[model samples]
Structures are given as C-alpha cells and as structure tokens.
Target: MFRKASRLRLDGSPRRVVLACCCALFVAASVVSAQQPPAQRITTNFKDADITQIAEAVSMATGRTFIIDPRVRAQVTMLSSTPMTPDAFYEAFLSILQVHGFIAVPSGDVIKIVPDANARTMPGTDLPDRPPSAADEIVTQVIAIKNVSAAQLVPVLRPLIPQYGHLAAHPASNVLIISDRAANVNRIARIIRRIDQAGDSDVEVVTLQNASAVEVVRIINSLYQQQQAAEGGGANPLRLAADERSNSVLVSGDPEQRLRIKTLIAHLDTPLESGGDTQVRYLRYADAEKVAALLKEQVTGIAQAAAPGGGQQAAPPQQQIDRNTTIIADPETNALVITAPPKVMKSLMSIVDKLDIRRMQVLIEAIIVEVQADKTAELGVNWAAWSEDDDTRFPAGGFISPVGGSSLVNLAQLAADPEAAAEAGIGIPNGTTLGIGRIAGTGVNFAAMLRALRGDANTNVLATPSAVTMDNQEAELKVAQEVPFITGQFTNTGAGGTLNPFQTIQREEVGTILKVTPQGGSWRT
Candidate 1:
C-alpha cells in the first residue's frame, strides 16, 4: 500500500510542475504582446470616394477613431500604389487633405476631420456649441519682457498673432498674456523668444526739475521733426511721451538713440542756482492787462536799444522774443508766470520791480455845489465846455473834458449868469456842478476854485478840505464845512474859536482818504 501511494504522489508532483510552467509561459507571452506596437500598415485605392470614407478607412487601418464633421461633404479620389506605415499614411493623407482645403486635428486617441475654413467653427461632441474656453483647447501663456513697457510692445506683437488669437498686455505688470490654438501659441512663444534673445533696448524715464512741461514737449517735438526729416521715409527709432502730471519724459529706443535723447534732455534741463530758473511775480494791486502791456513794451524797447542801430532797424519779431522764455499771465490769480534761463528770468524780475515801484501821490480836490432855484438861472453855464481861447479851464492847468453826458462850459460864464446855468441843467434844483482841482507836489488847496467863485453871491460850496497829509505814494485829506441851521437855535459850546453868528453856522464834515500806488506806469487809487 505504501509503494502504491508513493507512485501516485510522484505523478501528481510532475503534473503540478507542468501546470506551474504553463502558467509562467502564458504570463510571459501576455507581457510581450502588451509591450509590442499595434499593426498600422494599410493598402488602399479609390477611384472616387467621399473624404469621410477615406478618413474612415485610414482610421480602421491605424486603429484610431476619426470623427468627420457633418459640415464636410466633399468627395475625393486617391491611389496608394503600395502599403505604408501609419506615420507615412498620416503624412500623405494630411498632405492630400491640405491640397483640398481640409485638416486633421488629433484629440487624444481620436482625430477630428473637417474643412480648414470650418476647423474653428466645428463643435466637439462633448463640448457645447459655445466658444472654446481658454482653459481647454486654447493655451494661455504669460511672458515677461524686460526694458520695454507692455503698451509699447503691444502694437508690434498684435499683427503677429493669428486672427482668432487674443493678446493683451498689462503695462504696470509688464506681462503679456496670449490665448490661441496650441500651434499658434507655440509660434508666438518662439517669436518672443527670438526677440528676447536679440537683446532688449533700454527704457528710461527722466524727470524735469527746472524745465516746463510745455517747453519739454516743444523740444521733443522739434527733435522728432528733425529726426523725421533726416530719416526721410523710415519710422523713427526713438519714442518719447511726456507725462505732465509727473513732469517726466519716457524714452524708448535702441541703446544709441536712447542715449542721444537722454543726453539732449539732460543738457536742455540743466539746473540753475538756488532761486531756480523760473519766477512767478504776483501783482497785488495792478491790473494784469496793464502789467502785461507794460512788460511787452519795455522788453521790446530794451531789446531794440541793445541792437546795432540804437532802436532803429529792429530785429525780426521772432528773433526779438526769446524762445527759451515763456510768460503766462493768469488774471484769475493776478500773477505773471515766467519761465526762462537764469539771466533772462533775472532781467524780467528786475523789469517787473521797476515797473511796479510806487512813485508820487497827487491829491485831487473836488467841490460839489448846490445853488438856490432863483439864483440857478444866473449860473446857466456848462463847466466842461472849452473854446480855443479857454486855456485855464482846470485850476490844475488841464482841459476839463465833460464826463458822461454833461456838456463842458466856462465856469466864469456860469458865475456871471446863474439863471442861465440852471436853464442849461447846470445847477437847477437837483442839478450839480463840480469844481475840481489837483495839488501836484504838496499842500492841499481844498475849495481853492470855490473860494475864487465865492465872489458871486449866488455860488454855494457844499464841501471843504479840513486836513491834508501826503506820504510817499498816498495822501489823506479831510474837509470840514458849515451846515445851515434849519430851525434849531443853540449856542455852540465846543466851538473854541470865534463863531459866525450872522451865517447861523452849524458844523458838517465830509472827507475821503485813499492810498494810491503806481502800477505799470499808472496811478491806482
């Protein structure tokens, strides 16, 4: 029984060994099969076939699924004389499709076949009919550029992108974002890479400390014009933009051009002394019109006098006005904004000081008179009327022209005939006349003309000067007069001197004082 059992066990061991070996061999074969490439050979000929059918045959041979867009309805004819590998077949097929305005795009294991014009329009099976999200089919790339503002590069890069592509640049961030098909995105990347490899130009920002924004802009524009004229037809290499808010200039170009501009700006914007190259003078009490006129006239006169002919054969108008100087008068602020070189600004300030100095003060005395109704006709004469023989019309020795609508006449005639003067609207009831005189140097002669007119009993002067004080460019005058007592009769206790009891005198005083200053060669009170 033992011998029989031994034989059975030995047979079982052999069978088990054979089974283990067979399993090992099967696993090895499976691994080899998995590691091997799939068969991609094909042989085909078609007299005339729809492009869809051709795509289908190629897909079947290569074991790759191909989807034909419903919009593709074109038919094609082809002949493949010999069998070809999957790679070669794909290349040949794509070439043939390209000839017929079609393309094949791969999506993972699947291929999309469509007309070239409809490639972007065709919708994917799983994708909705909306535009492709940038996260999906389109690739987004952010590139950093050095020494160039994004705004400056956008124009140069825009035309390089495909029509369906999108490009945007953030100037502050100095980053460029591009969204497009993978191929186009790659192309743009290569382009940017090439540009970066070519080396970047320098971008500089220069702030103007002593230069006006207007002057800087003018200089830049003039330089650009000259550059354009020299270049004739080509684009200007240098680009300049002025920022008035920051009072700065931005420059971009090649190294040499940028250096040239920088040097030019530096030379033009050299700093002046501690006081600066510009000066703003405020005309406190002067009219801006008169000041500006005086400045122009005086500056022109000085320039002409300095010329060869002693104010004759003047220089051209353009040459007379210095280009480096700028004067802006702001009437709202009553200020003269002057910008120029140091010497020129100094000269302008001196001129302003001279023109704004205060000179002499003149005291004007005007007497207002009211005549009685019965005596008004005797004073019927126009005080402002002047004839060829009337040389002494004004006490100060100037012809007194009628102001407003009042007619000028002889005062002597008015004194002779007061009744006629009232008939001519000279001193009638509410009518008034002015006896005006001026004291040139010193001593206020208040009512001097009125005292002279007092010889006629009909004349009545209403106001008189009480005191006059003359300062450098100003004067103060006070006039005191007697007021007629209406019905009250009282003794004057404050009257220290002798009183005129016959005239029934009561005191009434009226005076006006003003400070006068000379502005732009004219007196302002």
Candidate 2:
C-alpha cells in the first residue's frame, strides 16, 4: 500500500511541474506581444495636396516616421476609397511622392523624401540641392546653312536664340552647332531651315558665253549700289562674283533683287539696232559679188532717172538721191549683208533674184586608157639557161642562179613564193603581184601601168582610177573629169560657111542701089 502511494505522489509532482512550465511560456509570449507595435490601418483621401501635406498625412495614418527634405517642393494628390493596410499606405504614399518628382528612401524606421531633380548625394551626405530645371536641361543640334556664310548668318540667328541657349558657327563647314532647351533648339532649327531655303532660292548662277565678265560684274555692282543708295543704306543682301573658270556670273541676293539684276543684264546683252531692218541673204560666191554691184548700179540709175524731165528741158539742179540701202558682200561666207528699210530691202532682194538667175552648168568628161608594158622583152631571155659567171650566155650579175643568189636578191620568181620573198630583201606587199602568171591580151597590168604613169605632168591623176584586172592582164579603167561652164555666154563665134555667089552679088547690088534711102538714093529707069 505504501509503494503504490509513493508512485501516485511522483505522478502528481510531474503534473505540477508541467503546469508551471506552461505558465512561464504564457508570460514570455505576453511580454513579447506588449513590446511590438500593432499593425496600423490607414484610410485617407487627399486632393491635389502639396507634397509636404501628403507626406504628413501618410506619416500620421501609418504611425511611421518620414523625414521630408526641404527641397521636395512638388505637389501630389492621393485617393484611396477603401481602408489601406500599412504596406499599402506606404506604397501609395511613396507613389505620390515619386509622381511629384520626389524620391522616397527609407532609413531604418524613417523615410526620407527628396526631389527627384535634387536626388543627387555627396559622398557623405544623403541629398544635394537641385539646379534649376530649365537652365540645367540642354540639347544639341547641328544645322546646315546653304549658300549663306555662317558668319553672316549667326548674327541674325543669335537674336532668335533664348537667353539660356548658345549658338556656335563653323564657318569653314557652313554648319551651326546649337545647345539649348529642347523647345528652344527646335525653334532655332525652324529659323535655320527658313533662312537656308530663302537663301537657296535667292542664289543663282548664269552661264555667259558672249558677254564680257568684267562688264557683267560692273553692271551688277552698279545696280546693287543704286539699290543701296535708294533704300537709304539698307541694301538687299547681295553678293556678286564673276567665276572665271566657268565664265559665269554668280548672283546671290533676295529673289526680287536677283530678278531685277537679271533683267538689267539681259538688256545689256541685247544687240542694239538702228531704225532699219538688217537681213542676211545667202548667195553663191560669184552671185554675192554680182548682187552687190547690181544693187549699187540700180540704186544709182533710179536716183539719176528721177531727175529733171529731159535733156532738152534744161534739167534743173541735180537733186541728190537718198541711197539709204547698204549692201555688203561677204566673200568668206558667200552671203549678202543688206541693211535698209523693210520695203527697200524687200525691193532689193527682188532685184537680186532677177540678176542672180544665171544657171551654172557643169560638164563632166571622162576617158579611160589602159597602158601595157612590152612584157615580150621577158620572152627573149631563157631564164632556165641563164646563170651567174656565164657572161657570154647571160649578162654578168644580171641572172643569178638560185644557188648563187644572195639573200637580198629581189628575183621575179620571189613574187610567187612568199617565204622566198621574205628570205630575199623584203616580202612583196599585198596585191603587189595582182596580175602575175595570168595573161589574156595586151591590156595593161594595172599595178605596172600605175607605176609607169606616176609622174606624168599633163595627165594629173586627180583620183586614182578604179582599175581591175579581168584575166590577170586585161584591166579596165574608169576616170572622172569636171568641166565648169556658165550659161548665156560663149567666147567663140562664127559666120555661115555656105554661100551663093548670085545671091551675094544681088545683095551687094541691092545694097548699093537703094530706092529712097536715108543716106543715098538711086533711080532706075
């Protein structure tokens, strides 16, 4: 019974120890719960509130610390219809700050808010002051200026640039480098485009062939100076230069000014004419001279014929004739240069047509002659029996045997053999042996005939005859001859050769014995 009681006591003691340990754990958990802050629920709606106000509201709602940088000046609005947890509240607050160009940074339990533009930090500091936004933001752009010098253009464009904008000109390259705000840079580019387009339209180069370069330059300068003087020194932007390489005048100015100058140049380049019309009539070489002479004679005759009535009428004082027509004969070009009134020129041309109607007939005569050399001389010599060193049988050194012939020997047989001919002096030229071996009749060997008639004096070969050999020997020749002749006149004339004696006698008697003739009279009774 005592042993069972001791065992029950031990069990009771373990239950008490278990109860004590549970009580200690409950106390420790209660202490930890008391030390931790409770999760806060936030609910807020702020409309277009300043960043400072938004930050203060967020801090009050979340029961968290927030340090707002003095430079965080951006405004923001926050709206939340439903209740927000602590995390949601922080997220919404930070998003508001960020939307208003502020950056929210957490440090331990506190959040630091700084302007986004001023978010830069020094090595040891958390935030630095932000520079002005407008002055700090810079953009660069390059613009091309055409036909206008950048030095001249920069001054005009500099005034258009904003105060904070900067412009630089690269004159050698004709480009402008501009640095300014995005809006200001765009404005400058527009101005540059307009200026460049205007300059392109104003600039022009005109090629001049017959006009004098110096004279053109002088005229352009004079016009520009006059414009300057008239406008009281506010002259058109004009640059005039004469390009000697291309022989052109480059005029760069306002379009109106260039037009005026071009008009003046046109007027200067036009040839001045007198009150009469000048006409050029082309005539034959001889006809040009004849027309000129005929015009002079006809004009003189008309002037003389319009004088007093008759010789017996005691012709009044000879009235001077107005020979207003001038005719010049240009032999070089075979043209008649006429300057007169329109009607007078027309009348003169009509007369010239009548006087220049003579026809020039050309007679062509031709004769073909075939000259043949007496090749029968070659028949007398037996070339097979002829040999060198046989002076009695064949002439010495005349007919050389093939074995004894030198390499420079030009034998007749070499003409047939090209290799042998090349071994001899020089190879025969093409067509040199055209009429060899083939013989028909005594007609000429054209090649030999040509050689024979080379230096003839009277028979001038104006053009080489179209000579062709029919059967290697018979050659036909075709030649052309020109005979120039003019119509209406022949130098030689003759009387009739056939005559009757009775008629001749009767004619002489009738001439001598006339009935009632003016000089003499004869009576036949």
Candidate 3:
C-alpha cells in the first residue's frame, strides 16, 4: 500500500528551498520546467539535482527504458509551482524518474521502484542512444498514403459525410472510425470496388467501419457465429458486446449464454462476469479506496448469493440469486471482467475485482470434466537394447567361458560390477524406455481425455489412477471377482484360462501429489 510521506510536505517553503536558492544559478535549466506548464504537468520539486542522473538510476532498477528529453524537462519546469517541500520535491523527482523510464511504485511511505517499460536486455547494459524505429504495421500504409495527399482526410469528409476522422489516431490497439465521403453512397461504393480489384493489401475501403481496432476484436470473437450465419448469410443483425477492458463477449439470446459468459469471465486474466446478452461491461479501478470497497462488496455478494434465500425472487429489489460463482481479477490493472445474465452482471459488477482462486478452481474443474470426456489418451515407452556388437560366445560360462572371444554386458551391470565388465570391455545400450498401462479389466478407451485434463508437463504425471474393489462370494482366485458391473473373470466363457483373481494384478496404482518442502523432501497429496 502507498501512503503519503511524513518527512515531506507541500508547503512553498522548506529547509531544502533555502539551500536550493543558493545553487539555483548553477542549475537554471533544472528548475525552469518546474513552472509555467499545465496543471497536469505540474510537479513538486527536486532539492537540487540533474533529472538525467535520476532517470539513469531509475532505469537501472526497473527493466524498462525511458528517455528524459530536454524538452520534457522544460515542460516539467514550466508547470511547477512556486516554492517546494521535501514531499513535493520527491513527487516531482519521482514523476520525472518515471517519464525517463522507471515505474515510480509507491509502497507505504517509501516509493518502491522498477523500470516503467518492459525491455529485454542484460543487466547494466545501457539503453540504445537512438530513438526506437517503428515496426511495419498495417496502419502505416494509411499514414503514408495520407502524407502524399496534402488534403487532410478531414477535408475529404467534412462537407459530404458524417465525418468521424478524429477517432483514427487512438494510440491503443483498438478500432477507430474513418467516415467515407465522395459526394454520395454510389461514389463510396465505386471506391470500394476499385480497391477490391486493385488488391491494396493494407488500405481497405469498406462500406462500414468494420475493421477498426475495437470492431476487429468483436469480429474475431464472433468468428464461429459469423461463420454459421455466413453459411446462410442474410440480413441478420450481428450484435457484439465487450466485458470491461474491451474484451468481446459471445452473443447469446438467453440463459445458457449467460452461464458460458460467466464461466469465461472466471477464466480471464482479468475477472469477467456474466451479464445479460444485451450488455458487455468492463470495470476499471486505480485508487486504493475504490479497490477496498469493491473487494468487500464482492465477497459479501458472493456469500449472500451462496445462501439459501440469496436468489429469492420475493426478496427486495437488491436481493440476488446466491450463486457463489468465482471471478478472476487482473493483478496489474485491478480490473474485473465478467459475463453474466444482465441482471447478475449489473448487480455483481461492483465487486468483480474481489474474485478469488477457489471459485476459479471449481470452474476450471468443470471445464476439465467436459474436456476430458471428449478426448482420448495414449502412452508409450522408449527403450534401450544391445546390438550385434554386444553379442559374444561364452565357452565355459556354465563352468566354461569364452577364453578369447569378446564378452558383453549391460551398462547397468558394467556400472555395478565395474572391475569385471571393464575387463571385458563389453558394449552396452543406453536409452529411454516407455510403456502404456492397460485398464485392468474393462479396457474402456479414455486415455486421451485423461491426459488432456491431468497431464503435468514438468513431472510426467498424465492421468488419475482409480481402483474399484470386487466381491468374491465363491472366494475362488481363478474366477473374476463377483463385481457389480463387470463380468466374472473366472467364468470367461471365452478361450483363455479361467480368470483367476489371485493371478490378476489389482489396480492399486494411485497418483501422489508432489510438493517440494523446505527440508527438500517430497510428500504425496
């Protein structure tokens, strides 16, 4: 949690101010930007120091790179207020530090830190001396063409169309509308026709602003629905909604879609909730007070909804169904995304940021069940063996061994009986081995599904092991135990020897949860 610093205050005069005055002449540039700028650009103050040096120190801490141009410094000075307190000085100092490249994270009284941007580079390495080159993106094509045409897009659209070109320059990765105007709809249609035939890969002219950042996202999510509609493509209206954070939602006409939306919300990196098919919502929160309030409400709501009378219709207008569905929250943004019945979405959105992991686990488990029931699992082994070079004749091994012929031994034996194997210098195979386990009796095909839901890449855990006990009234080892569902093994009316319970291996294998302890030993779940 970040808190105000006590040792500093915002008063115009402080001990540092008097000392700063004596040194002002030596660093006129450093103090200048601290005044004459917009209020948003206003800064506290620095006791006496070079912003460049401060930026460098901050850059070293966080992994991001920031540039503190002289112009930016001037802007800061121009916006600063008269006089300064240690606190004000610190805030200004930190702000500048951030602009230069470090994230000025506040932790209690201390301003915890890190690089504001994420850049991949070795520690202690300096940021490049030049500005970064722009990447080759689709938007660049439009910008290039616009540059060649001195007539601004504004001029082209102002007189003829509803003109919405101002939205084209949003910095974020989202859609922006560009109104089309060439006198009439026919002229616009003709332009589209020409572009379609000319094959201009990047600059597309569409009938509507369909491919803008936000719209593209909506179209991508509706890919499946759109495909289905396209098969029978007609005049059906395509509706799209986004949960908060601008994530698109699947449009559903009723309750089932509501549930799915809820489920997906629980899975997002940011918490998403189920809202009615009509509305998509995203909730953003930055302040600590708001964060606290949101969390408290979420927990209370979840608990109440889980209660018996929680969803009672007779309850007051605010009463909601007690469905303790889980919500997932984004750590960085403190935003919650949820898809719920419109009612639920509206009522529960306030607490979206308060979701926890337990609900997430339950939702995931449900998905696992659905996912596993539809897939197949397989297992195999990679093994090592001896080659022809390892073959040898033993003249008197059974009291007679090969006197002059080359002897052979496995690598394992050579390691254990080094003296003897080394003397023979026998060849050995070194490789891995794999094998699949068979279901003890039923032989049901479920391996693929089992693997999909349970496989752990790191430890080679691939499936849940289950066992069922069988009743043996006759108490005969040869006969299959008298199990409730399976046929008697001993009564095998088929060809093989009567199924003998004692001869068969029991399905006793079980998965053990692997946990690393502080003492370095492992324990099972």
User: Which candidate, 1 or 3, would have the higher TM-score against the true structure?
Assistant: 1
Q: For candidate 1, give the lDDT of residue 230.
A: 39
| Tens-digit lDDT string for candidate 2 (378-425) | 111112223333333332222232221221233344545768667755
Better of 1 and 2 by lDDT: 1
Decreasing lDDT order of the candidates? 1, 2, 3
Candidate closer to the true structure by lDDT (higher is better), 2 or 3: 2
Q: Any idea what lDDT model 3 has?
A: 0.33
Per-candidate local distance difference test: 0.55, 0.51, 0.33
lDDT, candidate 3, at 311: 54
Q: Please give the RMSD to the true structure for each candidate, in Å.
A: 28.5, 32.7, 40.7
Q: Which of the two candidates, 2 or 3, achieves a greater TM-score against the reference?
A: 2
Per-residue lDDT value at 505 in model 3? 36
Q: What TM-score against the true fold does each predicted structure earn?
A: 0.37, 0.22, 0.15
Task: For candidate 1, give the lDDT of residue 314.
Answer: 53
